[model samples]
Target chain A: MSPMPTESAIAEKRQQILQGAMEIFLHQGYEGTSMDRVATAAGVSKITIYKHFADKEGLFTALIEQIAEQRFNRVLGGIYLEKEPEEVLRHIATQILQLIASDEQYVAFFRLIMGESGRFPELAQLFVRALPQRAWKVLGNYFATHPKLDIANPEATARIFTGTVISYAITQYILHGEQIAPMPSDVLIENLVHLIVNQSSS
Target chain B: MSPMPTESAIAEKRQQILQGAMEIFLHQGYEGTSMDRVATAAGVSKITIYKHFADKEGLFTALIEQIAEQRFNRVLGGIYLEKEPEEVLRHIATQILQLIASDEQYVAFFRLIMGESGRFPELAQLFVRALPQRAWKVLGNYFATHPKLDIANPEATARIFTGTVISYAITQYILHGEQIAPMPSDVLIENLVHLIVNQSSS
Candidate 1:
């Protein structure tokens, strides 16, 4: 049985479902989870889940989109083009690593998204549409403003930089687990900053 | 409906099943696939597969071990530790990117292993036991001798450096589907070398 819902109440219920869904999705992955489990986890009726999201696919897509938007907005929002180039990039790199290390939900989310991306490719497309292209555009624009960088290829450089930070997190947390060697965040940021900043200046 | 295996032939049959299993596993993932599919793909009897591997778990474990050994050995083997540190690291990076980009079976194997790693944590452990630790030990030793370099944290730095490259390939090929980035491989290597070595020197 399902209760009739008002729009705002429905929205609140939807948010609750997404939060629970994120937890289960991150833990069990997409194929491993079910709508019934999500409904139970959310404390909402299964019919309520259906009413909010047409099916499991819809629910999953909505959940990914919602989080993607939040993540995109959060990370990208903090990245200011107006700042000095080196500082802005260092801030972005530090921001990325800090968020990956601290946010349990985010890491789980990334793991879930990556784990299932091969099976349900639209989830990947949703991520790509949300994040990378936008980051590239911002980065390219930033490099465009900095004629002194001597970077012949801003986009490629950005990929290299992006790859470096991401690979670090994956190795430390996901692949290597607790046995990984400890380096302070500042050391990483310092080394990375040195790599990106022009050395001729100093 | 199984033929008697000759003493010497069991090894050949096992090799055949393992080869076919990689393709099927890569395409369908762990749960979505079946032993029947693998047997059929291998052109071997179901009984033959069982005689060798007993069950899906056993078969998968063997397959993972085989692939991991091949992958880690093939990529890491080419880089001579005896070479200068900069040359060795650059060559290693290029080899890794090429492996991630071109080797579909390896990529598929990695994705499948990582995807199911949570449920079958032994697989993740297998990866750590096989690759990153050995790599760290080798790289750490290399960095220790390179006194002129300003590497404050050798092992952490290596992991970060490796992660960055892997993440780039995953984003470009597996996730985003950029078959080839605009830059040539050597040019890409040059740029990476610039960031890693030249930047540090200055």
Candidate 2:
């Protein structure tokens, strides 16, 4: 008996649905999740879910996009583009690790995406397109601005820099393996920073 | 009708079962997999799988142990306890990446384990205990041998090195997304080698 949701209200409701969907998807995976489950979790009716998202896949795509957008904004938010190259790269890696480790939703989202990636290849694509692509682009821009770093391949360097940080996080948390090698995150970052920031190390 | 198999033959057969199980487990996941599927993939009778492993968990455990043993042996195999520390460390990272990237079985094994890790928390422990533990031990031994690097905390350093390589692989293959960060594997190796080989800017 109430009035229909306004445009802003509808958008807000959609966000609420996505947040709930991410929680359930992270915990239960795409296959095991149901519209009823999402409805119950979001405290919305099943029809509302359908109204926002045509189906579960639609909901998932929206969630991934939202997470990707949030991560991109957070990492890109604090950059002092004109800072010293060494400190700049270090900050970027730190930001990346912090994102990977501190964000519970990010970790769970990563796990869910990775877990079902074989089945849902699109999810992986969305992540790369949304998050890593932006990261590499940002680093590439930084490198381009500071040609003095003598980094011949800024794009390649960006990938390696990002790769090293990601590798550290995955090994520590997901792999949870005993020290495959001894470089702690700080030491690793320090050494890596030294290697990349300098001009002639290659 | 055939000649009686020797003890080594029986052992070989057991290894074959484990290998097949690892593949199927990696592809199908724990919940999606069945003993019959493993047997079919292995080209062995159902009884052979049971003979070698008591159940699915037993097969998974045995697979983990086997992979751990192989990884440790490969990483530590040619490492001279007497070699210069920097050279040895770089060699280890380079070798580790080559192994992870090329070995189809390892890739499949990792994908399976990572995807299904949430359902089986014990799987995480098994992986860490088996692989990372031995890796840390090897790095520690290497550090103890080299007095030059003067690293106070070899354990942390080792973790970082391990994490970097894993991140590299995950981004390249597992996270496979569009506009992929394009860095030839050799470039990555060169960058890592640069980081580990030089302790000081001097």
Candidate 3:
């Protein structure tokens, strides 16, 4: 929109391009997406799109990082890691479970990334590093440092915590397990926190 | 291979075709696989393939069921349901985790099914019914019937047990989380069982 690309303006354009890319990628999947199509969707020329991203893979990687960071920030951003384990763990479990359950595009994007992972392993790697891995550090650190919890393997415990929630999502959404393995989301969340609370106390 | 289609021979042919289908489908994916490719791979005519399976979807569905059933039967079949909770549960966890980890095609098939879920929701439905749902019932019923465990909610607990294991696999294999959130397979398995055993006893 502006002739002179200020830093903020360039950042804004990049956001616009990523947004358009998400729409196309989700609708068409990774294999089906094209840079030309992205340019048209973003209201920019192909050259302009390339000016921002190195190539198709680079653009997709950026999109993956952006989405993962956004979700990570929203869910993991507010937690006081210093709080008691039950409450803090519960906050994270609730945030991730509900956040993933509600976001269909996010789920679809996940399927897309996973579906394409065989051909595009690096993309999957980008996602792992961006979201799940980052969440691990924050949660892992909390478990390690907290006096009350006193976990032996903070990393493993953290994985167990998020793993239950993520697998619940995988079964419920990814595998379409609601009709089959139908447990209320709250039941899972309650029991998850309960297990940790019980473990630490004993 | 046989001149006349004996009952045994027809079944044998079906197995051969499915083997070929799995190879083609995994490599080419559901969207890219064509009947002609399947016919060539199977060493059968398209008509012969059609006689065995009604359509491409039918063939893929059958393949999904076959893979899930084989794994299920292998893991759940030999386990003596009458065994104690810790031993039985540990057996199930080890079998499922090791079975999945060793089988790249199974993971790849899972990725294919999930990746194509948006476009072909029916395929996903088939998988849930075939694998996760079936596993849920077996484990859920065990939790319900077992007098020792005295689980508050058998279904929820079952989900937690399997969910943690599955999410473990998803991170390590599907999302390539080994580099990011690394942990040994035995560590995850041992801890998961320990958590359950502790909960039930308490």
Candidate 4:
């Protein structure tokens, strides 16, 4: 443009591009999506897109990072040591189930990751680093700090808790549980919370 | 005239075709795999494959059925009413983890099912019926009959048990847990069994 864009304008444009890219990526998947498609979808000049992201992989990485941040906020943001462990655990489990089970975009994004991970393992690695690993660390640290819980092993407990919720999500949402028989989300969350709290307290 | 194929010959050819189909399906996926490719991999004529199977879908179905049967045998083969609930649950858990975690072929097949499921939902339905649904029925029935365990909801309890193990396997194997940190199998099993048995008895 003839005039320089303002910082706010640049930030707004970047967000627009990322949102467009995520829509395309979720629908077409990583292999099927292209930078040109993203540019068109965003209604931005190729130059502007390139200004924000280096390439498709770069754009995809940015998109994943953005999603992870948003998800972390929605799911883990409320978790606090000040809250009782049951309340915190229930919040985490419920948020996770809501995100992974009910959200079509999140489920599709996960499917895209699982489908494309073999070819683009780096993307999978990026997701792993961004989400599950980070979540485990946060939860593990929380468990370790609360010795009153008497968890035999914080790391293993974290894995079990996260793993149970994730597994329930994958089966119910991704793996066609709707056609088979749907397990209500509350039931799953209740069972998981009970198991973890009971075992840890004992 | 060609000599008529014997019973054993027909069985051998079918097994060869199934084995070859499994390898190609795991490698190339459902869409990438072709009947001709299966014929070549099996070292049998396309005509022979067609004779044994109605079409590509049929071949894949047969292959899935075969895998399910074998897995059911290996994993749930030892369960008996006479065994201790603890022993039976532990056996089931160990077999499941061993099958899903370490078996590359099983993991690859699962990936194939998940990847293609969005496009070919029938395959996912077939898989759900063949494995998880079947396992749930058997385990649910077991839990329902064993009043000593006092499981409030056998169906939900079964889902929780199987879901926990399957989720752990997927995280550790499919979701790139190796890049993150790995949890030992025994620790997960120990925690899960303890939780289930304690809750049921209490």
Candidate 5:
């Protein structure tokens, strides 16, 4: 009889599968990709992948969750209400801009999502739940707690702030802002921060 | 022998072809659509379409220009610098929100452009030139001429203002805001206009 895999082994194998799945999904897109392709790319048996994830949909969901977690960790990780609001906001904006502009994988993933979400609208819902929805809740709560800032509508303000950042990213990366007059990331971020912070000051 | 078509007939035929092309392009996307389909949809011969437009690329460009012109007329045609700044800004905001949210053709066209633009980046450039770039110039010029406003960086401010509105549209419509906690369009526009107008006032 074959020996049972250790817990660590199982975790490592799951990670390998997810990483391989993301690469294929981003490159070939959701519909173009298949379980067989993911298995081949991961160099694991199809059975092994199934053991980790129920099916292709489950795998895609898991991948999105992973991405959201990784992004949250990278940008807003360790950030909280206690940190200076300006510094935290700047860091978040800078990180988001860098991810949007410089990260090839993120851009490819974004394009894949936008391209496929029309056909598979559930994917759009999954993404909205995974990232922006969660982020808005967290940030809005932070804003609400901080009475000094005097934000009238924390939820709406959070959406607007993040929405602006996201819009800049989409315009710059996805919409060919470079071919047009490229607004420097710093200028955009600075202006956004100034608008938000200064609005409160006044 | 067939007599030459009159100028009015030619214009009518061209309009028919463009209308058909828009429907097909929005439904099937750019790469999926073809000249033969457009001809069939328009109830015209392939030669007739070619007579109006040189090729598929030409037809596509003409269609984008038509969309831009139609949208401009509908939204900003009667708008002018002489109007109150608040009224003008609010009008523009309302018009943009209506277009982005309620216009099915525009949403489908936007999806088509975004979905296909990665493969055919020239489409992105074409769209940029057709709409937002031109709108920005006109709006920026209006802002600059308004000496009473005391605006700093008219160009950047105009971009930010419009960018915020566009971002709201994208999030609410394309990105599935309804699945999340939906914010009404009026709230977003009101908040955005308040932010910009109040920022200058302070």
Candidate 6:
């Protein structure tokens, strides 16, 4: 109507569609979701959704990719990879918990993925490739290079680091295990840091 | 027909209904699944299912409780609480992987829990209370009594232990992250045990 949508405007519209897709897909689930529902949720025409995404699968795949990039980049962005192990691990642990605390949507999306994994295995695969795979690699290389840590296997250590923190987040927030198995996130972070940086106890 | 079912016979039928509920609920989801579907899958009449389970929620609650007791008891039953940290931790780790490896049904049920947690928060709560809560308590108490490990806070340490191993299982089996971020379960188990008992490096 006004001028044709510019590149940035178009990108903004696309992001809006994805965000709406997340909400609808989570509520209706992958099988239950439809382009019509997504369009309604996004406040856009069905044709507009089709313009942005080839199909529901494409929309979902994009959703996984975007959520992964946004959350991981935000959590991993602040840390200087070269910092001491104690500082780096603490920063990572703190950032992860902080991000989970702030973002209910992301946590909900995680639930959707886990719940739908059996029906839509490819979605789970895309998520693994997008998020935890990258995390394991970055931390694995860090462990491998940090001679001081003396880790025999960097890859496994990387999984443990990311796994422990993520597990805590899932248990506390998603599983509501805080009531049943309460441990302050700070305590876990510090203890995890101590375990990794202070390995080889007397 | 036969005389009224004996106590053990009634118990067996109850178990069958729960198993069918798990399958239907896993496939159709919590909201999508109904008693009829469970009856068909379970080879029992809907009336029989009603005789045993009051509603879908009751059936699901029973599923959580039974799964927690069966797998956890199988895992925790063999380990003597009196063992050293190395022996105890390793035994728990191995037993978990073994159980996960052998039982696809349990793995699928885990995915179902994660996926359905959002819609049915109460189911998730039941699971945490039944499963992780017990594990955390046992391990926390074990760590507290074992002065040899010198753990300042056994509760957090217990969380780390269960959290790490469970996360590993989720990644390797549920997320299918093994190929992308491959670290054999044995490698992770050993590293985790090392971190816990081998803290305080030179």
Model 2 per-residue lDDT tens digits across residues A1-202: 9887698988889888887787787777676678888888988899989888877788887887788777777877777767778887778777777777777666667677677666666777777777777878888888867856777667766776776677666556665542432345667787667756754654
| C-alpha-based local distance difference test score of model 6 | 0.81
Which candidate tops TM-score? 6
Q: Please state every model's RMSD to the true fold in angstroms.
A: 4.5, 4.8, 3.6, 4.2, 4.2, 3.5
Q: What would the C-alpha RMSD of candidate 3 be, to one decimal place?
A: 3.6
TM-scores of all candidate predictions against the true structure:
0.80, 0.76, 0.87, 0.79, 0.80, 0.87
C-alpha positional error of residue A190 in candidate 1 after TM-score superposition, expressed in Å: 2.1
Where does candidate 3 clash, by residue pair?
none
Q: Considering DockQ, where higher is better, how would the candidates rank from best to worst? A: 6, 3, 4, 5, 1, 2
Could you give candidate 5's per-residue lDDT for residues B83-153 as a string of tens digits? 77877788898888887778877777677666656666776776776677777788888778876566656
Tens-place lDDT per residue, model 1, A81-189, is 6667678778898888888888767777777767667777777767866776677677766765686576766766776677777766765566545564445666776
The lDDT per prediction is 0.73, 0.70, 0.80, 0.77, 0.75, 0.81
Per-candidate DockQ versus the true complex?
A: 0.39, 0.34, 0.58, 0.41, 0.40, 0.60
Write one digit per residue (lDDT tens) for candidate 6, span B1-202.
8777589999999989988887887677776688888999999999998889787788877876777667667666667866778987898888888888788887887887887777677778877876778888888999888878878778888888888898988877887766766677888899889888776633
Off by over 4 Å in 2: A1-10, A32-35, A45-55, A147-153, A177-184, A198-202, B1-20, B34-66, B70-94, B136-161, B177-179, B198-202
- The most accurate candidate by DockQ is 6
lDDT of 6 by residue, A39-62 (tens): 888888989988888887889878
- Chain B only: TM-score of model 5: 0.83
lDDT of 3 by residue, A30-76 (tens): 76678889999999888988899998888988887787677667767
How many clashing pairs per prediction, in order? 3, 16, 0, 0, 0, 7
lDDT score at residue A71, model 2, on the 0-100 scale: 74
From the highest lDDT down, the ranking of the candidates is: 6, 3, 4, 5, 1, 2
lDDT of model 3, residue B172: 82
Each candidate: chain B TM-score? 0.85, 0.77, 0.83, 0.83, 0.83, 0.83
Residue-by-residue lDDT tens digits, candidate 1, B1-202: 8888587787888999998898788767777678899999999998889988879989988988887787788877767866665787788888888887787766676677667766777777778767866777777767666765666556656655666667666766566446323445566566666555554444
RMSD of 5: 4.2
Is 2 or 3 the stronger prediction by DockQ?
3
